[model samples]
Target: MPEVKEFRLPDLGEGLTEAEIVRWLVEVGEVVAVDQPVVEVETAKAMVEVPCPYGGVVTARFGEEGTELPVGAPLLTVAVGAPAETAAEPASAESSGNVLVGYGTGAPAARRRRVRRPGVGVPPLSDGSADGSADRSAVGDPAAPDGPEAGGHRRSSLRGPGAAATGGEAGPVAVVSPLVRKLAREHGLDLRALSGSGRDGLILRADVERALRAAAAPPEAVPEPTSAVAPRVPAAERIPLRGVRGAVAEKLGRSRREIPDATCWVDADATELLAARRAMNAADGPKVSLLALLARICTAALARYPGLNATVDTEAREIVRLPGVHLGFAAQTERGLVVPVVRDAHLRSAAGLSEEIARLTEAARSGTLTPADLTGGTFTLNNYGVFGVDGSTPIINHPEAAMLGVGRIAPKPWVHQGELAVRHVVQLSFTFDHRVCDGGTAGGFLRYVADCVEQPAVLLRSL
Candidate 1:
């Protein structure tokens, strides 16, 4: 006899409680291997392929694509230990260790053919039925008067259709999608009173919407008006803030509400920096990137003004100065803006930094960056100059102390060596949490960066 198992969605790290289903990798009636990716989900941080811990024949899947499921919701069911004729080998009860936060799986199992029991009343695997028998009272069966199809209306067996219902007790409401449940709750609709139209009598959003419309409809007895009337206005389009956009909104909102922040800007002649970059790239070694150079300068500036490279612990009422710099650079991709962190950035050289930045940028554009790659930054270097902008007061990434914004480096009129001349110049804007440091420290840090930008050799002293 085959033992059926239920696989629920696990907690993908970083306190994320829910994720939207992007795509399904496996289908019902498909054989899956241990620790094999079964579904792709988009959380607040990034898109992740969640692997199933159990290796068996998939019997059923719960949600559809684009459905947002909370942690711990049932994802699918697997029929393990099927008969030898059905599978290549018998499945062991042991699972491979710890694939996600909550679940584990054992060695990969051989592929097996999907097994289907006779009839729809077969209780779900969660019901713990040793014999593979469908629950006859399952939803959607017309014969199931006391089932979910009755819309929670329980009746006395002795009485006919006109008899009063007994107990006023209702059966389970067949609603699966959380979005549908939320919609009904927000509109104050009773799920038990409405029968579902979906397979298995599962309630859907369309059913709820139709009910609302019918409730709001005017009486048919009202006579049609002969006079011309104004046209009806179209409803506005709504976009849900759920995945990356929602995360950004939440972090930025918290930054604004909790942190007392300030911004300072300065314009610098970047001719030497540009010349130095060209000279460095001209060498036979790895080519240096302008952003990498800026990042290197930021690290040196933080070394001198470590106060700006720290976070404020509100509970302890103290500034937590980070020992090493984990630099985050903002990259805009088709999905949205993301800040991928470069670990131990202060320890990397110019060429090393360039390599890391390029790799992270590529990962960000391809939507492959992990949550670990997106978090833990002591400072952020935002090169908005790529957008061809002059300057911007960027919002500080929450929990981090400061962010340095670099604007477009273009030819500009400047007084160079006591003469007015066209020079490559760039604007530097620095935003910091006032709670971490005073304006003096912030100004010094910005001045140091601007100095390094103006004179590339100035950075050599720190190196």
Candidate 2:
């Protein structure tokens, strides 16, 4: 007989505690290889494929699709040590080490043991058997009561249907997912009052949603005719804020609540800057982007005024100035807006910065950026000009001291030297934390950036 091994969900990095099952790659009784991706899960950070460490026939799966599970919950069970013809190597050799962030498979897992509660007994599977078979009751079906031969434990509801008629006592609630409990609590719905339609009477998210809809339904009553006709009202739609959108919301909200910020804007003549970019790209081995040129200007400004390149330590009541610059640029994709950082950006030249910015942008658009790529940003550059806007007051990314916003550069009427002429002009907006610097420092930084935009030669002095 093969030994059964239970595989629990491992901790995804970046302080994520849970993930929702998007899809399952393998089914029950299917053979899986060592370190093979068994399921696809979506965390608050990104979509990840979780690989199983042990290689054998999958015996049981715990959750269905769209089910949210916390860390250390049982994901599946695998039966190892199959017949020699089925497996090429022994089960002991098939075990892997360091598969994910937290757990590993160097030794065989302990056998499954049941722990009895004070006044409740462990219920068997829906089929009243101990064999590891696929449970179909998870698909909105009520489970049958356990027989005497199985466990002799009767499935009792707390306040479900027919409680007043039988006058039965309340039992343990059949709920395991935290998401279901949260949904019920938010809507002021009592989980004990409704009957579950899941495996072994386990309550699911769908049950709570159904109860809410029932409560919100209007009562059937005849209405009297009015003098004027009533207008039809459209139904409102609700969307759950989860994944990338949810993360962005929480961070932006915290920034608004904590940071006392101020914004300053300057309009600069960018005709010379555009011409300089054209000249640089004309003879460069790698084409330099306009954004990269702006980034180069930003690095030069930070060198002159290091006060803007720092974060406030609230606990220590100190402003810690960072030595190196990890520049972050905002990129909007189909998923949402994401900031990808360029490590040691101050050391990179125009060509190097262009290369790194291109790589990170591609990764962001394809939804392949890791948590590390999205964090540890010392400063941020937001180019909202891509949306064809003239100007915007940018919100500072949380914990970062400052952000630079660039608007679209277009032809405008301006007094060039001694004559009124049509020139390419752009708007630059800078938002900074009031705690880091005063108005004079923020104004100096913005003026330096505007000068670079007006005359590219000013940037050459810093270079």
Which segments of model 2 are wrong by more than 4 Å?
83-93, 99-235
Q: TM-score for every candidate vs. truth?
A: 0.73, 0.71
lDDT of 2 by residue, 87-197 (tens): 223334266766463322344332211111121111222211256444322211122223332134454322243233356634334665544654665576777777789
Model 1 lDDT tens row, 1-463: 5677888889888888998876565545445666766777788998787777776666667665567999999887877654323333454444556757332234442443323332223234322234533221212212223433222345322222111134433333566554465466546677666667776556778888998888778747856679988857756646678788889999999988888889999999999999999999888989999999999999899889887889988999999999999999999976688999999999999999999999999988877888989999989999999999999988899999899999999999999999999999999999999888889999999999999999999998998
Please estimate how well model 2 matches the true structure, expressed as its whole-model Cα lDDT. 0.74
Q: Highest TM-score: which candidate?
A: 1
- The per-prediction tally of clashing pairs is 11, 0
Candidate 2 worst ten-residue window by lDDT: 113-122
Q: Which ten residues in a row have the lowest lDDT in candidate 1?
A: 155-164
